[model samples]
Structures are given as C-alpha cells and as structure tokens.
Target: MPRLEPGQPAPAWNLPTADGGRLSLSDLAGRKVVVYVYPAAMTPGCTTQACDFRDNEAVFAQHGYAVVGVSPDPVEKLATFVEKESLTFPLVSDEGKEMLTAYGAYGEKQNYGRTVVGVIRSTFVLDEEGKVEVAKYNVRAKGHVASLAKQLGISL
Candidate 1:
C-alpha cells in the first residue's frame, strides 16, 4: 500500500456525507483539514474516535482546522452514527473504497497478530495548500484526536 507522506499533496475527493450533503476536498481549500479514516461507524473504537474529534472540534476550528471523517459505511449508517453520537463533523461514505485506497487507509493490516486485509485506521493533516502536514497510519482510536492536536501544536 502506498501511504501519503508529509509534504505530499492530498488526493482530491468528492464524497457523499451523512447529512445528505456532498463534501469535496477542494471545498475546504485554503484551510487546514484533518481527514481521519476508520474501519466502520458506530463500532466501539470508531465511536470513541469520532466522539473525540467531535468533542475537540472547537479547538480545531479555533486553530483554523476542519475535521472530516471517512469510512466505507453507507450514508444511512453514517447518518445514524452522527445522530447517535451527536457528531459535529462531517462523515463521508467511501463505499467504493477508492478514496480509502488512494490515502492508503485500505489494504493489508495486522489485526491481533494476524495479517488481514481491511481498513487501516489512519489520519492525515493537510496544510492550507492541500499538502499533507502529517500522516499517521495504524492509529489507536481512543485519545487519537488529543494526540493529533498536541502534535499539531494546538492547545487542548
């Protein structure tokens, strides 16, 4: 799998969101964006991560950063997830797995010491110019947003 690297331009994307809306990477141009990919929506780990981002969304916005979540789940599932968790950010559906593959978030991964092919939890921070500022793969769900915020020098 080819993973994104710091300074690499982020791949363009236009995907359906949980809110019955469409979001494109270009739509957020000129602003920093945090694109996080997870295995599924509403699951334990995914829920924790989504809630973490939702909780810290203000801090990110205050720092001029927007958060977007990506997963293979359908729009309906994502919608339910958003409502159930009261998520503040947009969660895009990548049922085709094209975007996930482009970002190297899909493919082979180690699951409980076993090699498996599936979504690899990942996150990427894009600069204002759309170049990747940071890329982290195989990230843990809990406390991930906190760790990312600190890494990006955002206070809280």
Candidate 2:
C-alpha cells in the first residue's frame, strides 16, 4: 500500500486505547491530530519515541493537536507501557495492524542495512477536516517529536 499523502483524507480508525477507552478519528473531529505508529511497546526505540511525545504533549495540545500512538500490541501491554513510561497520551492497540496498513505504516523497510517486513515507524498529522497535513515514514525514534513539532511550527 502506498503511504498516505497530504490533502488525502486520513483513514478512519476506532481502536482500544491504553486508558480503557475507545478512540476514533470521529471522536477527534474538529481538531488537529498527531498519529504515530511504532513497532512495539516497551522496546527501547518505541519507549523513547513514546516518551518524546509524552514529554512534549503540552506543546502539541497548545497547538491544538492531539497525539495518539499505535502499535501491534495488546491493550494489556499498552496499558503497562503507558504506566511504566508515565505517558499521558492515548496509545491504541493495533494487534491486527489494520489501521497501520490503512495508513501505510506497516510494510517493507530497510533495517540495519537489511530488508525487513514490519511496522515502519511513521507519523501523520491530520487537519481539522481529517485530511492528512503531513505524512512521515521511516522516522527515527529519537528526536522525532521535536522534528515534528518544528514542522508544525510549534516552538517547543
């Protein structure tokens, strides 16, 4: 599947969140949303990326953007990850990778100089109208949030 592009409507999603609540794209209508997809929960890279978003969550909120994370982990594991990392944002369980595939966030990618098939660390910024404002794939875990913030014109 091709990656989503700017001006394209974001794929609809209704997934279980870490907080034991369901979150769907419609629930976040009228607001900009940051949806990031990671490979797994509790892994080093995933943890760093998640923490980066968590730490800068206020900045995202101040800019009217809601942050959400998706990974092929169960809701129970996601809840544990959130608790362990002190994450404040919602982390959706995508065990089936349905949402990930729809967003083109899961596919083949080069890892460690070798071709691999798995979740491609990616992020998408959706406008109030649910159109994709930005779509980034193969993003690095560290400093990703800062780069995204800069792209969105967020000072912090």
Candidate 3:
C-alpha cells in the first residue's frame, strides 16, 4: 500500500453515510477534515475510538476540523453503529474497500504477531485545500482522539 504523506492530495471520495445521505470530499472542501478508518463497527476498539471522536466533536469543530469515520461495513451496519453510539459525525460505508485502499487504510499489517490483510486503523487530517496535513497508520483505538487533538495542537 502506498502510504499517504503530508502535502499529498487526499484521494477523492463520495460515499454513503449512516444518515442515508451521500457525502463527497468536495462537500467538506472549505474546511479541515479528519477522515479515520476502522476495521468494523460496533466492535470494542472501534466503538471506543468512535465515541472518543464523538465526545470530542466540539473540540474538533473549535479547531476548524470536521471528523468523519469510515469502515468496510455496509450502510445498514453503519447506520446501526451511529444510532447505538449517538454519533454526531458521519460514519461512511465503504463496502467495496475502494476508498480504504486508496487511502492506504486497507492493507497488510501485523496482527497478533502475524501478518494479515485488513483495515489499518488510520487517520488523515486534510487541510482546507484537501491536502493531507497529517497522516497516521496502525494507531491504537484507545485515546486516539486525545492524541489526535494534541497532534493538531487543540486543547482538550
């Protein structure tokens, strides 16, 4: 997988959101966007990460950033996750993993000391122009929002 780097243009995407609406990267054109990829929804780690993002939604907004979550799950599953977690941000469905692969979020990685191909638990912070300002891979789910906030210099 090709790793994304700072200053690289984020891959364009128009995906189905949990709210039954489509959201394109273009829709967030004028704002900083944080696109995070997870392996599955409603799982323990994913849930923790998602809710962390949810809890920090205001902090992200205060710093002029919009948070988005992406997963390989289908739309129905994404919707369920949002409803269950009361997530305020969009949970996008990437059933085909096309967008995931493009973002280098889906690829081979170490799992339990074994190599496996799956979602890599990644995050990308895009500038207003959609250029990547920060890129991270294989991040731990726990405390990721706080870490991201620190990385972006936002006060909790």
Pick the lDDT winner: 1
Model 3 lDDT vs. the true structure?
A: 0.95
Clashing pairs in 2: none
TM-score of 3: 0.98
Q: What local lDDT does model 2 show for residue 109?
A: 91
Better of 2 and 3 by TM-score: 3
Per-residue alpha-carbon lDDT of candidate 1 for residues 10-126, written as tens digits (9 for 90 to 100): 999999999999999999999999999999998999999999999999999999999999999999999999999999999999999999999999999999999999999999999
lDDT of 3 at 85: 94
What is the lDDT for 24 in model 1?
Answer: 96
Off by over 4 Å in 1: none
C-alpha positional error of residue 107 in candidate 3 after TM-score superposition, expressed in Å = 0.9
lDDT of each: 0.96, 0.94, 0.95
* TM-score list, all predictions: 0.98, 0.97, 0.98
